[model samples]
Target: MTEHLDPDAMLVAYDAQLRAHVPPVLPAGVTAEHDGPLLRMVGFDHGGFVVPYRDLSGLDSAELDALIARQRDFFAARGERFEWKLYGHDLPADLPDRLIAAGFEPEELETVVIGPAAPLARPPVLPEGVTLREVSSRADLDRIAAMEEAVWGEDRQWLAEGLEKEIAADPDSVTVVVAEADGTVVSAGWVRYVPGTEFAGLWGGSTLAQWRGRGIYKALVAYRAIRAVERGYTYLQVDASPDSRPILNRLGLASITTTTPYVWSPAE
Candidate 1:
């Protein structure tokens, strides 16, 4: 039976799950600093400075505005360009559209899906000559990153670096796996098992164009779920793109809600 869920309630549940499980994978040199009611990070990337913000609810409107302004000043003083990522459902009703007024532009909406970890434990069948392997070395990591880059058309250097850091920081908490055929990776993904949270997040599920519809992606997801359950995670969550949503749906993951980001970039 399809269980009907209230969108608002689902959003709250999804947010809590995300906050608990998938804490921001901030880039290197990006420190997470809390300023009373504001949780922000500053990443000193060669591209410029990236500032990502999360709402800290203890503050009233006036205090929140003051904190935002202070962050802007701090970054400006460092001669860095700033970018703010505002989640769609996070804007307070009483708060003015100051971010937009500050020139933030809305980006595409993404869906947050969550479901039990059990469904992913089931074994998946891949096409002939394909096999799944868990990555354990720097060489494997590079290969996985390269496959992801080729599949998604994005430079995955950042992702590889982040994963390497996580594995080094907490070896038991991170897992990267790839599906390969005749020594070439065709699909890949990773899962992060966050302590103190009931969720495990699946990330970077990219498959080669020629590999679509062959159950490689689903098998990768199942592999992660199995690992998540083994580590006692009750929920599996993903910020799914449209290409992956249908597969997740077929796997019984419910779409909790949509998450859109409003971006404030220096160029805008």
Candidate 2:
């Protein structure tokens, strides 16, 4: 982390590590299966997830088209929604178009940013009257869902369900924290110390509208970074939204790729 980092080289390592299935096992309620080069996780509370390993270069046009359709049917049979995690650098260049043609809808684009965790583990910097606390109770989890709902104007009941299952399976691998002021949760986030990898994935940082630009989000990042560092992780990673991408970049995480989700919902 001290010497100048070669972003390209580090990114290559990150891709390789991910392709190897760094976690190696899904949570208890979920399962993984392979469709040729693509690995899919099924039974998440939200639905299935396609791992974005970026290994589609070898498939021909027809073969790729069939692969996309197959995933759609696979999920439809179970009446579940699914997502194909597509990155800007994923090969076949037309993969995004192919997904769209298969009835998949593209969602928000995010940057895949990563950085050395050591430097980011400084004491959290929160605004006056704000305090961050690590959370575990069901009440705390419900509060996080409420915070997310207020930020995005939708029911986020799925967050509590998924986080509960994950925490029950391995308390050591995940950490959830919330920023509180005036006895209410204002911002929340979590970090997963993915097993068998050098990286810890950071999720959330959903702050209430009234709390924007107050450094609570950044403090959440720093707090998660500290947990990652203490847990022996070398790098911190996030699929950064536009609002957070600039802040993370300034904090030293390199934006190596752009990830956009292409989703398919089962017909009612």
Candidate 3:
């Protein structure tokens, strides 16, 4: 068995190698601008997003407040839902409180779990009636989108649009997977390999409520881990939700830190 890593040191290394060294994930023709330490991404597949690419370990109160307001205005003028990705180690000692005061609602607090992808590639022992595979057909696309929507209780338009772009490009950087039972998609997930980095992100690991207790979710993670190793990615990372954190931890991924998204939705 592989030894579990020290979470703090691993998170520091991840911030440097993956978060700072790589550009924000965006489709072709979409662009982002850097303002101080903030990266303002526009026209990304899933609306607008703001990332603090580096540590904000030195900002004063006034400056921090201005930065938050600037980000809000940048997205508000574009009429986009803005997501500010926040790490647990973010500076000023009260960043989360500031974000909430700025009308940014706190989303789910997720554990930043990461580990070697190869170890997670063990053959998935799925339940008797279920099968897992890479999704390819348009019919499967719709099914996957529907499954995600049902699981999250949200619309799947952005998810579908993002998946379609990835499918059309076939860039080998992203792959979508789904679990099916009796011809219905019961769970769906995807893995995105970031260029110039050692990490691949596992996202959208959602299963229908009724399919919760089965091993379907674990099977999906294993399938994606194998795919990540195939693409030469050393680490598989995920912002694991509360429901999935224990499962990932059991699979040997370390819960390095907590990450939360502060969302500021511009008036529609």
RMSD of each: 3.9, 1.6, 2.0
TM-score of each model, paired residue for residue: 0.80, 0.96, 0.92
Q: For model 1, what is the alpha-carbon lDDT of residue 124?
A: 70
Clashes of each: 0, 0, 0
C-alpha lDDT of candidate 1 relative to the true structure: 0.69
| Per-residue C-alpha lDDT of model 1 across residues 31-127, encoded as one tens digit per residue | 6666554555565442232222334456677876776677666666665555554454454643337655554455666787877787569887778
Candidates sorted by TM-score, best first:
2, 3, 1
Total residue pair clashes for candidate 3: 0
Off by over 4 Å in 2: 1-3, 19-25
Of 2 and 3, the candidate ahead on lDDT is: 2
lDDT by residue (59-157, candidate 3, tens digit) is 788988899999998888888887998887777568888899998999889988888898898888899899988876677788888888888788886
Q: Write candidate 2's Cα lDDT for 1-268 as tens digits.
A: 4245677876797788765373544567798888887888898898888875586879899999988889999999999999999988889898998999999999999999889998989999889999999988888999999999999999998898888888887788799999999999999999998777888999998999999999998899999999999989998889999999999988889888899999999877
Q: Candidate 1 has what TM-score?
A: 0.80
Q: Give the winner by TM-score: 2 or 3.
A: 2
